[model samples]
Target: MAAPILKWKRLTNATGPSPRPRHGHRAVAIKDLMIIFGGGNEGIVDELHVYNTATNQWFIPALKGENPPGCAAYGFVCDGLSKILMFGGMIEYGKYSNELFELNATRWEWKKLKPKPPRNGSPPCPRLGHSFTLAGNKVFLFGGLANESDDPKNNIPKYLNDLYTLEMKVSTNTYAWETPLVGGDLPPPRESHTAVAYCDKNGSNYRLIVYGGMSGCRLGDLWVLDIGAMLWTKPTVFGIPPLPRSLHSSTIIGNKMYVFGGWVPLVMDDVKVAAHEKEWKCTNTLGCLNLDTMKWEHLTMEMVEDSMPRARAGHCAVATHTRLYIWSGRDGYRKAWNNQVCFKDLWFLETEKPVAPSRVQLVRASTNTLEVCWGAVPTAEAYILQLQKYDMPLTPAKTPTGNPPLSPMKATGVFRPAVVG
Candidate 1:
């Protein structure tokens, strides 16, 4: 059997108005359409761009109601209905907001939501570079940088580790914040991490899997939070792990969590250079985590240079049933200054399932000719046939055999047979 191959295809000739090159954007998939929200290039952007997966087109849809201000590093999620929920992000250099807004997917309208305060203290603080995951009717938010000082020159910011959920009240058309009382060990305060919701086999319990972030330094830890039990525990993971990174994207398909592209901080040997300058290393590597076996698998693809995307961070990735779409990220070219490069192109990572041909049959066509047939595999692009002759030796010596190798024959149609001599 042949190993399954993952292919990356760059989308071309996308029609309609394309969004400007920017990073720190947020995207969510609904059916065949992907909706992208705020990010920044020269400055912050508030325009909304929609990409149709079936048609390979892009368009800016006119929105109604009060539009949210231009911002980046915000949290966005689709409720699986026709609505997308957006939360905390930085609007500008010294500004961070905790405002919540909703986009009506079907009507193309926007509405600012004011959730009733939690029964306890105040709501979660204003932040950016956080993560949001939707499970059932609630959206979970965790870990981001909340600016504490008003001075724009003050680079140091406060990182948060608190977790909160926004529950929708359908009858009243409102939302309520709830801080669950969680037990067990919790992750440290960090920002620019990724979180994905995974359901168990029976579909009775849900878990939020978190991987990698930065808390003054890069992190490569894995933690899981049980929504029902209100517990947090670091799972024991096997296999080779990815390097410490932040600002990456993690998408869950089946029991696998696909992580791609992020920023890794660099340390310098010179004390003066280390103290005055800070550098980041961008990566294009991809990794997968198996939830069932608790193992990590790094995916390596063989493709041409132009076929793959550059090493980047602060990008957005959304997964469908069969494909993962990636777009718009900042590529830091390993320089300490003037190295930020924002992208405007789009790429698709195709994860094809392996399916072997079935109902195979063989028939003698002539004196030395034989025909082989099989049922077509829906997901397979090609098929392979192996033949062994009775006259050939069962075991080969260390010396060369000099025997002619068999070549593959191409057969078209669903049940077409290929003849061999």
Candidate 2:
């Protein structure tokens, strides 16, 4: 038990050659790179990797035009700009694709979107294990599975809870689809659930914290979506939360929300000669939900014994300010897998931080010479340290008498940089 601690740190010595095996694939982080796309290995996969978390390396994004045909349960994000979009999935014969692709890492290109009817059709429902998040510039799809004959016995594969909002209209650069101003509390049509987006300091708004999945059965319930006025709140926290799962993996730190692993169902009972042996067990537990004390924490692997990562379920963890970049998925035992085993490793969860020495000082602004910045601590305004103009080089070169880190008092005005050539 004390001997499985691969203390984490193996950023990718395998990305291409391991690009097949999949699981509800779709990763998105625009700046430091992590584009990933599509999934469902032995069948659907127009493939598109891009790891590079600051050069941890893994690249396979040749991007050509008209692409959105190869997929496996889709949904993507990253509107901080470099382009990503992607929508709908399930490709190859039993088809279902509402076509929409963007990708574009500065002309790598993909662009095939055309669902324009009242703005890209109101809300993602071409279905495929749904869940997507990217607030503040909008993009909030949820739930999934609504069509294309998966025939789970006349259920016709329709399990969507419906909640959509795209709204990224940068001067009609396109994307408008709205209608998720739920305002009346919703959360029921589950499909591999998991949605994060916090910041509700006493109702300043923005809180979409759903959890668990599979409404037909496995679900450890917990819901809240209150992006100010567009309501939905159900919080009654108190320790231990993470049981009854679906394709699991949720990440967010700052307002907490870190769930991992999934698949839970053990109904065995072959008593005499009858027949009953349902299965789907993969648990190395680790769930924490503390959107500022909505509590719930059960992190077992014998309590982070070796910094966990064994029981997987459609893997895709994403966080940075430190680490937490789990990739790939599907350890759902004997069911849906493309067999690349252990889901093609690439762990990295390092987080310790107690050492503090962060400073930043730059002031050349008497009225916009533009270099005004200040930081050294955060006695707290919730955190707002703004400083730009770094074409690269921030290791220890921000002099102005160097003790410079004094932001987080909301760091007052002035920030203008939208002149893109």
**lDDT to native, each model:** 0.81, 0.64
Tens digits of per-residue lDDT for model 1, 220-295? 8999998899899998899999877898999877788888899865654555543333676888888888888889
Q: Weakest 10 consecutive residues, lDDT, candidate 1?
A: 405-414
Model 1 local distance difference test score = 0.81
Candidate 1 backbone overlaps, count: 0
lDDT, model 2: 0.64
In model 1, pairs of residues that clash are: none
In model 2, which runs have C-alpha deviations exceeding 4 angstroms?
1-12, 15-57, 66-109, 112-163, 166-176, 185-231, 240-295, 300-421
**Model 2 — TM-score against the truth?**
0.29
Clashes of each: 0, 9
Tell me, by TM-score, which candidate is best: 1
Off by over 4 Å in 1: 152-156, 265-278, 333-339, 354-421
The 10-residue segment of model 2 with minimum total lDDT is 412-421
